[model samples]
Target: ANTVQVQVILDRSVPDRTALDIYSRPESGGDWTHHATAVLVSDGAEPGGARPSWPPRDADALDVDDVYEALTAAGLHYGPAFRGLRAAWRRGNELFAEVALPEDRHDEAGRFGIHPALLDAAVHLPAWAGLAEVPEGRNRLPFAWSGVRLHASGATHLRVHVVLGEAGSLSLQATDPSGTPVVSIDTLSARLVSSEQLKPAGRGVGDALFRVDWQPLELGPVNRESWAVLGDHGLAEALRGTGVSVSHYPDLTTLTGAVQAGEPTPDLIVLPITTHTGTEAGSGSQQAAQDPG
Candidate 1:
């Protein structure tokens, strides 16, 4: 195999952040050959006729490992199986790069599940075209999606292409190793926002209780206090306004009997938050916190 060389080019914008090209060649010539490219990204305008500091002039000798380390430090762990960026450079109005996706991403269905979360992270590859720079400290933020599609379930290799669009949006397309279309993602966008800005869109509460844990409770016990709290919380009012049915359990024994008879339990179970004794205490509480069908 022959050695393959990988090069990274950061555009004129933030010229100093550019990294040197990398090379990888096989010791045996009989195996398949692979090649890749990358680009750097930055926040400022391009420098005119400026040369990159090269040849290890002083204490700082920029190397491929240094750039890769910077990306990893910035929470850029896309997974170790995928190959790193090869050659990177910026175009007139956008940034571009060529990356090699590993052959192991396919699933048994002959298609990649390609979860929305994983696709979103791949969009950041093009950002490296500007230059390698330390990212500002920030917590993980949620990303929004208008639409996404996974064209193929399983693909051994991939070619990733990205473009930054208007309104701080990004577009990405992944192709097979032979340059054939594997997946096309459109109307995609992402942003870095505070955690407080993210919230669940719906609200509901429920719990499940098992028979073993319920066996010790006294029968015919009523939780009037819990009932009052539910009433004050507007749960009863909310139920009354809707067609949903609400049931009251007099004691844990009744709940366990229902379970033994294979009857569906109520969605919500009212239990006092007071402490309990024995192993049932911890186990019962855990069961209560679980989702009930």
Candidate 2:
């Protein structure tokens, strides 16, 4: 494409919080593809917080070589830069790992809170963590991440703590050598995928990934008698300009409270939302992620 638009929109509701995503069409006439999504927030706690001592005294040491080999056999091949899982130990369902980027990459760590290679390595430790009880050969793929916070930037070596949660979720807390938190993930959810589903595409036309075609919707004129807009009022102003009278409210809770307090009820309520694509909706937990670098 000759030109593409990349937008960065900030959340005015929350200070120092933002969400970023990109969508670009392959050609000028093709539909846009969602490249990626990531959020940055300041709600996370700072480093030097309370945590267990470096490596727990009672946990048995795991052979790093065997661990890497097992990962390869499972089809997760780690390159040298990503081979950061130096030592790991498991005490019950929890896992502790020591991860670091190669020495050459250490100097580049100052720009971010744990390099992506090292962070990816730290999260993979949970696979060998004896986490779930399922049949053999089941593939687990991470889909969504929630409550991710990067506490500090520039840490090559990190001590990580991972706790398995619920049925298919886990949490990660990585700290610097002195125990200052670098990055924390409240929940990293993964779903069990079948081996047949994990197989490479292009085996035949029947196994190919589906292409998306967007259709224009025919929107009818407004049919509401009275309306109320919740949260942001920018949309409400637009509707007003179009001759649609909309009562603005800070949020739904307050709007309902007013109705309960004898205020006139609205015939319609409006808010902004973004829905996932058809592929994203249909794939659900079955989406196959690319191989680990």
Candidate 3:
């Protein structure tokens, strides 16, 4: 039957800890079988080490698109807002990355130290796990966690550090945009489970797992007579060929000032987004932008 039973074992000697086991039957008239056990502890969690430096100077910058493509090939799908892995780097046994929650997910950020989806992005960093050899085609689940501590809450963007453990585990630490500690995990253990365990006997485990929910965006055309762009000299020069008027501003602040002083305001504004692309300390950045209209 799909209905399962939960049993908890508590010790009077140690009231702060409890053991839990779940039992389910394979068929309507089958034997009751133990499915899972989890032990809950109310103590022993401690804050982790100091925050590491941001943008590791020696790590090789990884192609963010390549990283996501590899994960998708491995059957790990991420939705639009969930694809928050902006950039990544690797330096031997250590991995670092930049992650952010989309503006749409910011409303729910206060509900968690780090939104579950954002924390999940951190897990994908292990896709760069080249410091050691990994087994092939093994499906492992992280069922146990230890030394988890939350330093701060409501972070939208983070700089993450992941150190592969000597054994097959993960140690994670995350900080906010300004390098304030946000969360730390000492060790998260992943135990291998056989395919038989996943299928069980009667239950369709796939029904209980999560799937990518993709919402289609409704796009429409826009008509603008004037355009304003800042920071990118190349784009401004290109727009000069178009018959429409193009105004170039030195920066966003200057653009705002012209609009406030009764100067002509363009129908649409274009701004440049700076992104770090190299492992060097003072490397330059490339620009990306969406349709401003």
Candidate 4:
């Protein structure tokens, strides 16, 4: 989990000339298993690292569906369901594509941060675009990566771009709709294989579509369970660290009194955490504990 190194195989005769095998131990102290293997194609560059060769004379192409199938077949379950591909297109030797974000990826403040899983998924866009190549046949190999960056937050979409450079090197970039770059990869100095000519191990391709819902939490006194849940999940941490406070009122009568008295009640009010809980008037008791000031 700390670091990952992959192996790549290449064959000059095949159209798809790159393949990758990722190896990882089940646990920190557990045995190693061939986690996943994928095929890609490149004109004549190395697999991992930057500064391999340069702009390949020829371009390589690989099926998007095949790569997805290989990933799940290798026991790397993406999630509950795979959304369909968002978009795919080609420009010269370069390829571009997009994929949807998962639904369960929400942050504690009722907002979402860039999930690490999605970060891994974003890196695959370049390979899917045909900017790089994988090897052919049924082989489990490993690939190496250098730097990865998560620049944007609350991203609901992903985009990939790949450019072939001198000496068989490839430059890849991934971003979101706001044009915020998430990751950049330069792989030419590393070892790599091509697998564009091989038939996929399976016929079915995983879906790449997802539906997400964003709900804002009301900022008011909530029940013990709600307060604890929010705190444990991160809301409380954010409030405590930032010196923010939440106030709750028992009913509309008290709320109206405060409003008429020329006091701003609250920007938002969340109902009691429990269904059977009655209106407990004023600041309640938990609010004081949470915000002594």
- Highest TM-score, which number? 2
Instruction: Name model 2 segments beyond 4 Å from true.
Output: 1-17, 22-44, 47-49, 130-132, 194-293
List ranges where model 4 is wrong by over 4 Å: 1-67, 70-85, 106-113, 125-135, 138-142, 165-169, 188-293
Clash count in backbone of candidate 2: 1
Give the higher-TM-score candidate: 3 or 4.
3
Candidate 3 or 2, higher lDDT: 2
The whole-model C-alpha lDDT of candidate 4 against the native structure comes to 0.47
Number of clashing pairs per prediction, in order: 29, 1, 0, 48
Sort the predicted structures by TM-score, highest score first.
2, 3, 1, 4
Model 4, residue 109: C-alpha shift (Å): 12
For 1-293, candidate 3 gives per-residue lDDT tens digits of: 25554444444455776666666543444445555665667765555466556688889988877766655544455777778888989888788989998888999999986798888777677743531244443344566777777778888888889887755588888888887888888897766544345543344443343446799999898665888889788898888887657899888778778878888767777787776768867666645433332
> Lowest summed lDDT over 10 consecutive residues: which window, candidate 2?
284-293
lDDT of 1 by residue, 74-104 (tens): 4444454443444333444344344444434
Q: How does candidate 1 fare on TM-score?
A: 0.36
- What is residue 205's positional error in candidate 2, in angstroms? 8.1
TM-score of each: 0.36, 0.58, 0.51, 0.35
lDDT of 3 at 84: 85
lDDT digits (tens) for residues 1-293 of candidate 4: 13433444443555555555666432323334465554554333323333322222343433566666665443333543244345555558575666555555434212545555555555454433322343332222225443334355666666666665543455666676555665566562223433442333323543222445599988997633222212233444554455445434454455556567875545444333432435766433442122111
Error of 1 at 78 (Å): 4.4
lDDT of 2 by residue, 1-293 (tens): 13555544445465786767756542333445565687776663554447787687677776766766665555555678888888888777688899889999888887765688878888777765432364565646677889887878888988988888876689888888888778888899887765556654333443233576699999999665777887768999988888877889887778878888888788777755534557554533322222111
